[model samples]
Target: MNKSLIEKPAGCSSSILSRCRAAMLIGVSAILGSSSSDAAMNVGQNLDGITYYSSGSVFANSFKACGAWLTSPVAGGAWDTGFGDKGPSTDAAFVMRTDGYPTVVPFTAGGVSQYVHTLAPVYENGTHRLYFTGKGTVKYSGPGVAATTRVLTGGTVTFDVTVTGTNDLAAYNATGPSLRKGPSSWYIDILVSNSTDPVRDIRIMRPGYNTSGRDTFDSDFKTKLGFYHTFRVMDWLRTNNSPYTKFANTNGKDGTGIGKDFYSQGTGRGVSVDHICDLANETAKNIWICVPHAFTNAGMNDMAASFASKIGVGRKVHVEYSNEVWNGMFQQATWVAANVSGANTPQKYGTKAAEVFTAFKTKFDAAGKGSQLNRTLAGQAANSWILDNSLITAGSLTDSIAIAPYFGKVFTSLPSPLPTMDQLATDTYTIMPSVRSWLDSHKTLALSKGKVLLCYEGGQHYVGTGGSENNEALTDLLVDFNRDWRMKNLYRYTYMGDVNSRGVQLFTAFTLSSQWGKWGSWGSMEWLKQPIGPNSYEAGKEWGIRDWKTNNP
Candidate 1:
């Protein structure tokens, strides 16, 4: 839902409900429509399942234990350490520290002085060779450096490194590599013949890394069986802010262009479709893919065919046109608003979504896998009219209507001296009735149209907007609120409790793990390494959802 539509009233009691009602009314007035019948409420519907919305893939991201990168190094540039003024470096190279580094170094002389391109290999400890194709010199610095240098002669070159215990970046940086921790600044420099473009097809051939062709995912990632039911790859594919119109090549070179190497810079085009399919096949998890809005009919057909052929047997595919086309905050919404022709934004989105669904359905049906596809039409949870208009226009093409039924938007705009943790909890609990009412209306509409109800994203949405996020006091309050034990109760009891009883078939939590800051505390846990369990104070939203699944199952 658009943030501009929600208003923060002075009082906590009325503020939350009024904001929800205001958004609901705005949606109702946007389009004129009515449902003929309401589906009978299922009193105690067993939760179909609970899944996670994954955090995006980036060099600094710590969500996956095996790490997002295979062997490709972090791109060289001025490092944004979130403070200020980190020094410069050569292209395709990384610096360990600006204080100890030299500037204006030649590419032939190892790019930058005292700089070693860092990589996060698998957690397993042993001798492993980091492989890459091209003529280059591999040099290692910091701890775990077994063989310092290996010369490359336009062929695969392997550098050996021995890791001890679990690779924790904080410990590695603080006290070197230990049995329980690894350094974040473990550096390996690869100076290739081509200065502009470094090495190609870099592979970290470690024990838990992609050493075997069968199991490519990290050991820690694969061990989390609860999160494997479905993996939404919106962030993995870099769907937002993407400009891809065609499929990424599986064998393309790194740094050439968009959609090339799977390990290209995080800001570049997304990973290949082959990698996404491989992840699903290896993990045996259903994949929810968001088609890029810029894709043409041919591109859509190609993507569908690729998934139909490559996706493992019996694993389902949840297909959404794009991530929130109705929310004007994203580029896709803006693109549709300008490019797509319709009576309104919902109709235009519906028209394009129908076309996308048709393309995927045709290919999947042709491949004899139509039953494995879940065609989802997403809309704002607060707005029934968006779904009403879109679903009506989409007709039989959509199999499910998806929405994000999050609570706590009232806190986003609340002024300084924000509500206390107890007050926020009260407001959260008070708003449950309204959220349930909204769900009841949408569930009925979905059933009336013969479509299932699914949640693409949902959880505590207590982030500030405009310049409110910059308020240090507000940021501190929100962070503390997330860490508080009461927040867990609200998630397990009020939020998930409501959705489960309301008969939402699938409720995917907003995200897996992320660092909490001014932007938003979207992650269930602060990071993958954070302690998680019923007794652990560090456990927050992740524990709540996990505990719910255990009891419900």
Candidate 2:
């Protein structure tokens, strides 16, 4: 189900690769060419267009800014990810006991038992309740020194929270310890047991990052602005009979007909335009919303109308259908195959896409808002074949086409001895020419029909497929080897998107935040929960944010 960029079997291993060296390179799809360089810190051998160098600085040549794909918030004070919170004490999820010298022992602050640290911890879906019975006061403290203490009542108290970005815990910065401190960038809840007697103040709180000397590794906790999703257990959800939802608050029944939030009552499975607007409250900017093709016509209308009413007029609302429908990993792809007639055929996919778009557009038109010409982007597969039966089917309904300019395949179909990360980076570059040619031809085709091209998904896929190529050790080694130039090529692709200024209209990167993996660096924010510090691949996250900010379309 993982997007198969290469045709290698999932079970193929390095041993098999070694034995079939010559067979590996046969008939691979490539039409590489050398590209002229404009970067200031060039460091690679340009052989037929791909740069073989293993290291270099990110392109400072005025990066092409685009919108970051916001999917989930990643903020945890843990060392490992992918397992959620099952690691050692470095776990993002933690439990604190205020009895007898801190039995849980979450942190070691100058020999004193500190209870908080910066973490992109999980606050599962729902309310974090507090039950108070006996009389007792709870105190919250710690950052650098742990001096401040906020008090609250015991019996029963509630706090609403959601995942956002956590600020970096720099040992150099000051504002309290700064360690373990998760500002408004995070959503937390406090739960206590119900007691008959007046219970003391049991506060659920967080501390800043530890700046002192321990600023080297990940502190207990930290955070930034509100992101999308963060992995957390749902234990935070409380049953208080109040039944009031946090963000939407459209609990139980509402006279307004519309739910408090977008997905609260929508026919689709993901967030809606109003949901993005809700996010707008945190981001305070126009947003790009990817609507699922599965949405009912009614849901699409509500989403469209919601965008018009909430986002205000003239605000940019970049919209697209289900992401990568060509890839069967997602339900949309499978749904199309089983539902849409003839969509199973490669030639009929575009037709199915166009049909999907037209159906959504119909609802949008009924809403009497949103410029399909300027806003709606017809999503396409990342594959080279741009022309599809759907293009003709949509006809005038399609004005802009969206494609993912993703390249940099590492583990797919490599030569026998296996190339180094440097070679992988170089090989990725060789792919640009073919993509450029495709884009150029597509531009002519689009412009002929008064349409434009855009990149709905953009990032690096330079990872191995299954078998030994899927070995975690190899993955780590490559991550270390290509850390520098890998990013360079990533930015390189962004620049490629602007080929002759007729390339991509909006380059929406694959995501805004994620954990370690091929797609880890793809986010504007690293799955900050893992990795030691900024020295890790997460540095690319900053570069992503910078690039997005540069060309703020």
Candidate 3:
């Protein structure tokens, strides 16, 4: 529910406020030494420490009980997001075949035929819920076609869209299109071109995490990644077929086992470590767990002792505390950014992040837990063979580093308009060297202790127009990215997981292709089929890709 509106009580004139302040000095929560119109207690002012702002006030009689005012903050608490695609009110685009010439006559809002330019169009989603309307049509090139005879009735067409951000023309396809969830957060995609031509080949994908301000299904997805649940999925895989290694959390706690709680009972809002152990004990295979954040020290120690006492400690379950703390790749940035004054305040977050991690580590060691007690830190600040003076002086902290060489293009060119998908990819490879230099400088720091450096997350983006026949480059790019970066301890951002298409490119493709079906296959047995790409029919010879891969590949 939205927070209640706050307003100053009526009869709160200057004299009355002074008296109220005097009487409530000790009764009030704040003990500040200020009392004026601009003071925090005044009307339309943020009361709590939270940063909320009030809209312009409507002058009302101060003599009345009170004047209600609205206070809406950018983000004050849990976000209540909307669901489902908003369908357009217009009819579907009409397919016309006249005089032996076939053409697509776009529907217009007004009942009239308008002329328009011709361009070859191919779409990803088969279920065209949205349609474009345009007046006039170019003459067909067929031999028997008559000039100036071709006409298209312009009107509305059914399109599913939720307008967000400045780019209103953009819409979310089940395929990859950067999108956000909530009241009206615009989609976040690297603009390829500001060209007048309508964009095609632009692929939208959902994000694993919405650090880029894109909406995401992470809260739901996190449930699947639970230490125990992921193990079940992995076990199902290995027992039935493939041989993949299991991943462990940073604390070195095995997928299955008990861990003591240093503080209160393990009641924090996180997937339970014991749950993973229970699954593993049930004979699950290929279980992996990577707890993104370090548990409080007391909790960590308790978990370690509990785990060791039950199953005995080993390397099967691994844990790394300080991994990629400084990189823009991980969600750690979100926690750091939250405490920061603004996105531009690098020093604010940078120093605070180190302090938080340091406290976390001290508690872990003091509690006495885990087989590998030493924390592994990654993404530390470095310059050549020495630590960066700025980070060192600024109090950057971590034991090891996890570097993710995520070098890609934000755009073909930024000063002017954007570029197309093809142009975006070309620009990525061209800008790769700057990324290499950054990595090399850090690698020089390896001159000292063999600090752990793991590639925690890595992948390349695919931007292209057209269908399977024309967009082969996308598949090839994915194959190459996997081949190059598939190293030990590496975890890809996605493994075909998403209920909605927002920031992730692959899942969006599946969504846009009508792969989920008319009702969205969300709760039905068919929902499992949503992950299959458009080529599922040809590749799986079955409706569901998961089933197809399970049975065939």
Candidate 4:
């Protein structure tokens, strides 16, 4: 699940009393927030249609980042676990920082004795199999990293070992001799350690890979995620809690000649806007961007100008300011509450959103792409009054009002003895009417405001909350429910039916894919090419979305 899914439950805050009351009245609960060959031909038509949700962030365990060159953020210290700029407190035995290089040459026994490491996505349990290609003298130990005499002298090293129980990367150990002299490209197919040991630099560091103007994104990533009409990059860009306050602080260059060598991952700022635009171009999809809340006016203008100049000629751009500013769980909400002067949080968000919209519009107009720009105002789905208040300030500048009308929140806090899969399915049928009512009111509101309604994020919100997620039995039940055919039917028939009938112009689901654990089963499919069964469990939410799209088209 994306970071957005880890937010506090709806109505948890006092500011949203109305939302809670509205949710109760409608029987809706908890807030959560597809295709290939045939998808390409319908690109133009799909722009006004549904698109896939935003891609997940670049993490060691990220399904999106797997099979790619980049891994998790580098850690540096004596024990091989330090992050950011924390200097080594004890003897500096080893160090692996950003720029994909270790300052230290050799790994000491003490340094590599016990250390944290990065693991490939979906390699947490069972037998781990992977290949490494690089130039290094290293040894590995631990359940996650197979114990082996590692040798990477321009040849691939293979690891085929079974790990019992949970494979924790933090318990890995490593020992290595001095790295080979001269520049060498270190690429690991797996066991990319996110540690402070010298081995980390060798495994995670490699230069001149993406600079050749070749495909930077993983082929699997493109094939699995590229079919969307528009790609929302809220998570991809790391727009929430953004560290960028100026254009110079960004990772990639802007304008026509956007730089090829962008530091896409291993930093909080995330993939640069230039690279995101490149992704949109490569996939032949429209782009949806979330402006960083911390960006200055000058910085925003620079980003907007770059987006205007670089986005593909025919593709559209959907612009929103930050993400979920109404939710206090995010920094953007606090930022608006403090920085932007308004009567309330909604008004402040609206004011900032209008500014952001105007900035992009100005640049798009100057670039003769104004018609392709769609400015969106995102509001809480359960609370129409939030939209009403926000639109009062930003309606004239907005093209659409976006909401995340997810279902299954009521299940998050269900009592002990969780409902059986069949019972859960039956209960799901009861919730759609309220959900449909919620959509109808929002659609009505959007129409009254002379704007189309858009679903920025929406899907089944069946995950537990308030520590209920930690209940292994409940987690099993929820995961099984998502896998059931009933879940797919709910999405294909009930959920999409409600969305389409309400006249939603565009609907993007919550996420693409991620591992289903205690965090929440937010992924439509756990991973790309995860076998959909002839059995009901095999065909999960992704199949449902595919069926809906096929039928709707």
Candidate 5:
């Protein structure tokens, strides 16, 4: 008994019937074609002689069709953080039939699901293309009677940039650079020596009463601390011949340039964000810029979209959503990590931290916009044990990890009333094992998804206490350690910590000698000078003994 498959639609034209039979013989693999008004379709005839037609459309709704996914519930319906007006902000998706019938759908502004009815079919090159409209779509193969086995490999793919040449190494060891060994790394004694010219100044004197909480704007210090100084340091680095490991404002969850009162109020945490962009434009150089903030709420997507539009999509700018949401201290410090400092914040991390994370991922993966996201997750640890599995394992979400640990002594010259350097090294070493253990556990859980780890911001504290000898030893250890691991990216604590001399009891001798006198000095008074660590002058720019030897006292 030989086998002969047949397909017959009652009352159909002979030509249609003939085409149907041929299609059946070709099996379920669609040989879909379009002839202007007449669309040709292929159907597989089963043992019962019943045939099925491929019907559907492809649309650009879901971020190239890789938007939100249906997993658990949140708030009400499937937790949908909803992307900005521009669909999925990250990845892309498509479906295909072995017979050449194709349908492709992309995300629409971070939607949980796209509109289905409006999908369109694309016909070209003897092939008919189908795509999803709004809602997420699934691809199924085989005869319609009983579809068997789930096909899991039919989506876009991307790869990380492999570090090549000595460029990365050279940059890693540039002047005043920080170092890392395995998981533990910190800033060292590198110096940025400026010409004998006055360091820089912004003198504002108001004759009227100071309604903003102080009399003389001079005495009321603000510039002596925070990322403002960080910006200055970065600015100086750019002008100099240093390699650029860029920095930017990523805190956009709530509003613009890190909310209004970020340092105190939960507003504008990443105020210096604009500074990064401005710096890039002014220099016209392609440097690694990062937005330090969490994308917990929809705010990240909006900010990302805005920045992408300005910077042009798929450029060198890197935007990290939420700085460190995994840390236990998220409520108070979430903005610091996420970088969302704007007016009338869209949402907060009440019970929505995980939801925000999920939404952030969905948006990032929905559109091909992921190319614009060099998302990083930053965290602080007292020791190596701080980087356990729980910190990173979150599906295919995170891109990079920035570990900020004040491992060495509190200050380079003074000793803290705390633990010793040996203990510090021991604790720092423990972090690598903990990170490894955590990564191993999460790798198993996620099958090794997400970005490999990197330390973004970790430094030896130099504010209050810590033995000078310990600081020196730690510095040497960091140099040796960084050489060993060849850490990806490293940023020290900060540029200026001379704010301690503001009030009476707390004084510091460290002030940038200015033309009009120390800009940070008060009322023409030379305050009790407390020498900050070796690099405190220009924040490690001139700290290298090479420069010191050449310059002398």
Candidate 6:
């Protein structure tokens, strides 16, 4: 826990140096709203003390709502917004826009029906200013929040806000037809104290008849909100999402997609994301870094140590190689099989993953974090081949074998006339047995070999057609059902210790923060803008607050 353990990597490449520059510019923009639109003029002036932020780059494309899906659309295609030569500009403004609308489930149906935008919260002009756009006049009710102007139709709206610890929010669009259709989105940021420090709470509140954006704010609303419970245990690196480059040009998605780009690792979006500043501002989080296969050692270490210093050495960290190595949809998957010498068979992908793991481990260990780390191994979860094959060396080469046992994939492939939420729940629970079997066999095998089992990514791999007008009602049902069932019990705890399976110990919810519409519906619960409620991902982290506090304290 000493400061000595907080190591900052030296000798970053020229590219990383540029990235640091981009990151620096973003920090400044976060405090002083970008001079792009009227939202900045009004909102920035009204809410003088609050800061605003989008998940990643606002220009990044939205993950495309309700269309070709799995059959015709590409695999892992939806995952990558834009990367490589086709990425975003590092000089892009800090914005929060998505490609398509990840339609919302009506609030009346127990789903959040809106999008949540984020601002980092800054104080100027005697008060911090916050701004966002809504469908109609909506009244926001929460802790220490007062809207300067909440009227008219879709344009920049401003609010004067203050926060202590975690805050709760709800919007009432009286002029709009109904809560579900009227309220568009609410932008919120949390502050632990009056100090000028930034708050990283960016959960979106969607319009809905049955929406409730509640969270298990375990951390004192006065202290480092939610840090003890959620932030401490989380792997923030987002492995595959990290984009290390040659010219600090995050070339990452900087925002064109619209409402889809939740986290930036793809086309560097808004303010050209450099998560280092993100970590420094919200220091409670532990990163889940996935070192891009092509990144330079200096660049990778720079990111690793920067994260270590912010998170501190006392915290446990996960060093994963690439994102999803087995999935052929991603570039990494294709590159691994085609390029890595003998990395031909699907089994060999794990071997490649191990290589990346080893490489990063050497860097972290050199940085004096040997005892505070876990070298995670990635593998295909649904398949039995990866259950106990080349992916592991019993007790060596890996600390945990990552698996993906999603419950909703079964429902996604069906054509139209989708089953109701009740049916979805029924069918999902029915599949639990087989899922438990698969997890049990693999989990048992891994534990026997002295390696821990983790869900590298797990969630409802299905995104309903709710984003479409025709399936809107059905979407509401699905969202409601997911919220009532899948969101909490199933994803975070339900199968935690099933009858037969040893149970997945630590699994990343397929993903963490995602834009509204399909990706926001299921699997990843890190954060949801629209259908986001108190029991959203925030509650998931809160589930272990008491235990975490007791153990760590």
Per-residue CA lDDT of model 3 for 1-553, tens digit only, reads 0000011111121111111000000010011111222111100000000000101000010001111111111223212111100111112232212110113222221333321222111112212121223333323211121222223344422223222132111232335322211111111111111112221111111222112121112232232122111121211111111111122222222121212221101111222344344434433322222323333444444444443333323323333332233434334444545644533324443354354445444544454433333233334322222233213423335444433222222111122333433343233333233433444455545334444333232222222222221233343332232222221001111111111011111110111111111111111111111222223112121123233113221
| Number of the predicted model whose TM-score against the real structure is largest | 1
* Error at 512, model 4, angstroms: 1.0
> What is the TM-score of each predicted model, taking all chains together?
0.72, 0.52, 0.32, 0.69, 0.30, 0.52
Compose the digit string of candidate 5's lDDT tens values, residues 272-372.
23333443343342223333333334454454444444443343443333333344333334343354332212222222233434544455456555565
Ranking by TM-score: 1, 4, 2, 6, 3, 5
What's the lDDT for candidate 5?
0.24
Candidate 6, 1-553: lDDT as tens digits: 0000000111111111011000000000111111222111000000000013222211111111111101111121232122112234321222212321112111111121221222221111122233333343333333234443344344444443443322222222244211121112222211111112122112232112012222211122214223221221122222333333422322223222111123322233222124323432444444444566545545555545544444465656666666555554455666667766552445565565555566556756777877767777765554556536555332366787765544442222334676654455344343344444555567667768788766554344333322342344544555455445333443223322221124445534423332223222422322222332345434342232222223323
lDDT of 2: 0.34
lDDT of 2 by residue, 109-226 (tens): 3333233221112211222222222333333222222233323444444332222333332111243211122222121111121233323222222222111111111122222322
lDDT of each: 0.54, 0.34, 0.24, 0.54, 0.24, 0.35
Q: How large an RMSD does model 1 have?
A: 9.7
Q: How accurate is candidate 1 locally (lDDT)?
A: 0.54
Model 3's C-alpha root-mean-square deviation from the true structure amounts to: 27.1
Residue runs of model 1 more than 4 Å from their true location after superposition:
1-128, 138-150, 162-190, 194-198, 205-215, 248-261, 265-267, 409-416, 428-434
Per-residue accuracy of model 4 over 1-553 as CA lDDT, tens digit each: 1011111255332111011111222222122111122321111111111011112222222212322222222234442333312211223443433432333333343434323232223324444344344454544443344456665555555555444444222221232211111111112322333233333322221122212122245445566555467667676665656656655432122211123332223234455566677767887888777888878888779889988998889888989998888877677789899999899999999999999999999999999999999999988776788888999899899999988766654444657566876666555444545555666678889989999788777666665656675676776677677777767766665566556656677778766654454445555655443544435535378777766666767
For lDDT, candidate 3 versus 6, the one ahead is 6
Looking at candidate 1, what is the lDDT of residue 204? 51
TM-score winner, 3 or 4: 4
lDDT of 1 at 499: 60
Q: Which stretches of candidate 6 lie above 4 Å from their native place? A: 1-285, 305-311, 343-348, 387-395, 409-418, 428-433, 459-462, 465-470, 485-493, 499-503, 510-516, 523-553
Residue 325 alpha-carbon offset, candidate 2, angstroms:
1.8
